[model samples]
Target chain A: MKKVLGVTLGILTAIGGFVDIGDLVTNALVGARFGLHLAWVVIVGVIGICLYAEMCGRVVAMSGRPVFDLIRERLGPRTGLLTLVASFLVTLLTLIAEIGGVALALELASGVHYLLWMPLAAFAVWLVIWRVKFSRLEQVFGLLGLLLVVFAVALFTLGPDWGQLLHQATRPHPIGHENWATYAYYGIALFGAAMTPYEVFFFSSGGVEEKWTRSDLVTARSNVFVGFPLGGLLSLAIMGGAAVLFLPAGIKVETLGQVTLPVAVALGKLGLAIVLIGVFAATFGAALETALSCGYTIAQYRGWQWGKFVRPREASRFHVVIIVCLVLAMLTLLTAVDPVQVTEYSVVFAAMALPLTYLPILIVANDPDYVGEEKNGPVRNAFGLVYLALLTVASAAAIPLMIITKGGQ
Target chain B: MPGESGRVLHAQLHLLDRQLIDQADGHLAGKVDDVELDLDADPPVVTALITGRERITARRIVDITTAVTVSVEDLDLDYYDDWVENHVIAKIPGARHAPE
Candidate 1:
């Protein structure tokens, strides 16, 4: 019974842990603009993340080493340092976007400017990282993030034609009005949103943080296999909600309000309020994950003690890095960049950085010295390699696609 | 020690940057930054390993003493060095045949 409960908790956390500001913004944007024509991208993104995350989680569990640690060992100092700098810059940019996301959530809640709340939000994220225990932090935000389920509920409440929605999801083409470049651009964003590098960094590190050994591998698999797919469902629901309400009405999702507008249209102001709370929790919760992940990637690379499991003074360098990242992120937001725009660019950058993060995990997971008896079987290896090739193509094309589409206009 | 039983291992291939886990408890102490080789015999062998932030700093920086003196002075240097020497520098059990 206890084992069952643990597996259930892991799944719940993964579900809540999955959607972030990127997922919310990208899914809604694509849904409103291209309808369900690009829904297949979410499926590809979800599978890609699952394959790599499972590999990373297994590597950590069997080897007792985080992904970045092995990355440095395998790639050597110079090349490893290069990957670190690139991954760190991308993660830091995403952190800035997430902080902006949190402040935006606060603005949606309180009617105050998001910029005014940026410093306070940054400080709050730092305090949680400084003081909270790993399990407590995971449970509180992970479950609270489930409030995003309201989007799915709102979709059903709106009572759209399920057959038509299914037809659009299956058809995979720009409906009469949109062009191929914009459709492809939004497809890349959805993929980027789902398979962000920080998610794997956080997931594998969290597995290590929880001390998941070989015995705990089952739970880890359960979380990825069950929880991540459900989380993908939540993202799809957000897309579906937008497809139903925003696409037909010729609306573009520029603000948090439009992301929740379908909820309001389906379930009135009360449902809107509930959905707003969900959005706030999802974004702020992701803010915490991404901010901590920035520190995790850096400290793990340098072999410093990290994670909320350790006291701050004991892991001074880790805490110091996180504080610095938060301060820098807060400053970045204070430059008055639009949070939504920052969120969009961060996702595109995430798409561009995809191969760097995934390739290392694929290499390490297949390595017998690292994974020991539980290394990737041939079938998993085939899928992982295919995804690696696909990720390389997607990453190479991402920037050009962004420029050509002008970020989906 | 298994580290001594083997022929001279390639530090970069076999040891450098691998996690330094406590043999008894599996607590991750640090990584193998650099190894100390003993040349007192006819053929030199790596006698002890150094694993600490200060050691890492001292190896890379010219003025590590000036930099670490502030933090190191507070530490019982002899005891700290002994602790790192005994506990954190053991050989990885299955890492010997790792392909270069």
Candidate 2:
């Protein structure tokens, strides 16, 4: 019974932690603009994330070092330093988008402008980091985030034609008046959202924080296998709900309010209330993950002590980095720039940063010193090679695609 | 570094650029920037270690430098006052042991 409960909680957190402002914004926007035309990208992205994240967890368990630490050893100082800068910036951009998202969720809930909520939202996220236990933080938000299941419920309530939805997903191209360029742009963005750099850093570092060993490998693999696909299901639910309502009505999802409009229409006020809470929990939970990811990446590279396990003063540099990142994110949001726009660009850039960390993990996963006997088998390496080519293509094409489509117009 | 015997470990692969930790308090002292050894003895003896900040510093551009040759016996966790220990030694899940 205890083992079941332990594994269940891990799976729940992985599912919840998987979605963030990136998915909340990009998935809905794609769903609204192109219906299910780009949905295949979500499947591709989730599989890619699972493969890399598993390798990272295995290395952390075997080497007692996070992904970035191994990156330095494999890439040398100059290349490692370059990887750090690129990843740090993308993570920071994601952190800013999440903080803005939390503020936006608050605005929807409280009927106040989101800008007024920015500082307070940032403070709340930081206070939790400073005051709450890591496990407790994971539990509260992870469970609450499940309220996003409202999208799945609402999708069923609307009673859409299932075959047509599946047909669109299978065909996977621009629908109606949508263009090929914009379709490709959103596809890359969805891909970015699923395989965000912070997820790997946070997962591997979380393994170290949780003290995983070779014994825990089964548990870790099970969590990824069960949890992440469920997370992808939730993302598709959001997209389907949006497609059934917004795409037909010609309402594009430019705001968080539109993202939940389907729930409100399908289930009335109670569902809206529940979905709002879900948004709040998902974004706020992600804010914590990205902020801590900032600390994890920087500290792991510098060999500084990091993690919520210690007194704040003991890991002084780590704490300082988190605080600074939160402040910078808040300041960026205060410029009145759109959070959704930041989210779109962040995910695309996440694609660009993919090769930086992913390449190192793939290389190190093959090394005996790091992964021991748990090294990548033929099947895993085969998938790894496919993703290597895919990520390289996505990274090379993301910038030009973003510019070509004018950020998907 | 491990339980295996009669295995060859490469210097660049195993020692260089790996994290350095002080075994006394588990505080991260630094990374293995460079090492020094005495060549006079058969098989040689490590006289001292060079701690340079540039190679390991994350905040600045890395300073280009030539490699140094060092001859030393690689000791297990029990021998060295400073060492690297995998986070696995703490068996409990989410136990909050070994922050970095």
Candidate 3:
């Protein structure tokens, strides 16, 4: 029973931590516009992240250093710093978007202006970071994040034709009224959302923060295999919810309100309430993840002491970075820019930032000094190399696609 | 002790720029900024492990007392800038490797 509870908790957190503002917006946007023509991207992205995150966990278990530190080690400082800056900004942008997401969820729940809720939401996130124990923080959010299963519940209750949804997903082409460019653009966005760089950063660093050992590799792997796929399934459920309601009605998902409309349509006020809680926990959890990542990237690159495992004073530099980042993110949100737009650009940047983060992990996973006897087996290396190529293509095409599609129009 | 087992580390590849964790306090003091080697020996010996730290200066940014630095003078990272720029970052156009 203890083992089962551990696996369940790890999976819940992974699934909860999985759907940040990026996944919520991108999957919904794509499903509404393209109607599962790009569902394959979510599947591909899930497998890619599973393969990607597993290596990061492996490296942490072996070397006790997280992926960001490994990024500097494998790539020299100049290149590493370059990678660090790009990934850092992407993470910062994600932090901004997630704060906005939490605020939006609070607004939906309370009917207060999301802008009014922004400061309090950010403060709550900061306080949690400053005081909460690492495991407790993760468990609280992870369990609460499972509240997102309401999306699945709503999708089932909506009584949409499962055959039609699966058929739409299996078909490889865009539906009418949308061009292939827009479809491809959202494909990249959805893929980016599913495999954001912060997830890997949080996973590996969270491993070290929790003091993972060789014995804990199973726990980590279970988190990836069990938790992530379930989270990816939730993303698809959001996509399905959009496909069922918005596509036929010719509605576009441009706001958090629109994203949750299908839930309200299917399950009424109770469903709406439950889904809102899930959104709050998931976004707030991801907000913490991305904010901590901002500190992790800079601190790890500069070799500053970093982690929540140490006393607050011990990792003062890391704490300072986190506080500074949260303030900057809140200021960005204060500009009243649309959080959905932030979510869109952030994920595209995430796709662009992928190769820089993952290449080093793949390279170091094969290094004897790092992984030793636990180095990548042929199956893992094969998947790693394939994802490397795909990531390169996505990174190369992300900007051009954004420009050509006018940010997916 | 890096060379104690008769194991040789490629200077640029392995030794330089790794995080420096101090054994006494076990804080990540800094990174390996430069390694002083005695090539005069038959097998070179790593003589000094150099780590230069940038002073943590608190700047009032947006009314927050935050630590910030813009100088490398405090760091012994002089050798890396030249070598990494020419060999590593310089070789890749735009300092980023993207297949057009």
Top model number, lDDT: 3
Say which candidate scores most in DockQ: 2
DockQ of each: 0.11, 0.15, 0.14
Q: Residue A106 CA error for candidate 3 (Å)?
A: 1.0
Instruction: Please list the residue runs of candidate 1 whose C-alpha ends up more than 4 Å from where it truly belongs after superposition.
Output: B1-4, B7-11, B21-100
Residue-level lDDT tens digits of model 1 in B16-88: 6665543333334455566666578546655544556434322221111100111222323234323433443
lDDT of 1: 0.77
TM-score of chain B of 3: 0.45
Cα RMSD, model 3: 9.8
Query: Residue pairs in steric clash, candidate 1?
Result: none
Which pairs clash (backbone N, Cα, C closer than 3 Å) in model 2? Answer: none
lDDT of 1 by residue, A1-409 (tens): 9999989998998898899889998999888987888889999999989888888889888876787887777777677788788778878888887888888878877899999999999988876776667787887888988888989999999999999899999998887678887777777788889999889988889888888899988998988999999999999999999999988889889987788888889889888788877787777778888888888888777666576665454455566678789989988788898888888888888888888778778888877777888888999999998988887887888889888877778
Q: lDDT-based ranking, best first?
A: 3, 2, 1
| DockQ of candidate 2 against the true complex | 0.15
Q: Which tens-of-lDDT digit does each residue in A151-180 have in candidate 3? A: 889899999998999899899888888888
Residue-level lDDT tens digits of model 2 in A1-409: 8878888988997787778989988889988888898889999999999999889888877877788888887887779899999999999999999989999888998999999999999999988887687878877888889889999999999999999898888887798788888888888899989999999998888887778888788778877988899999999999999988988888888988998998999999999999999999999999999999998888877766677876565566677788889999988998999998899899999989988889989998998767778899999999999999999899999889888888888
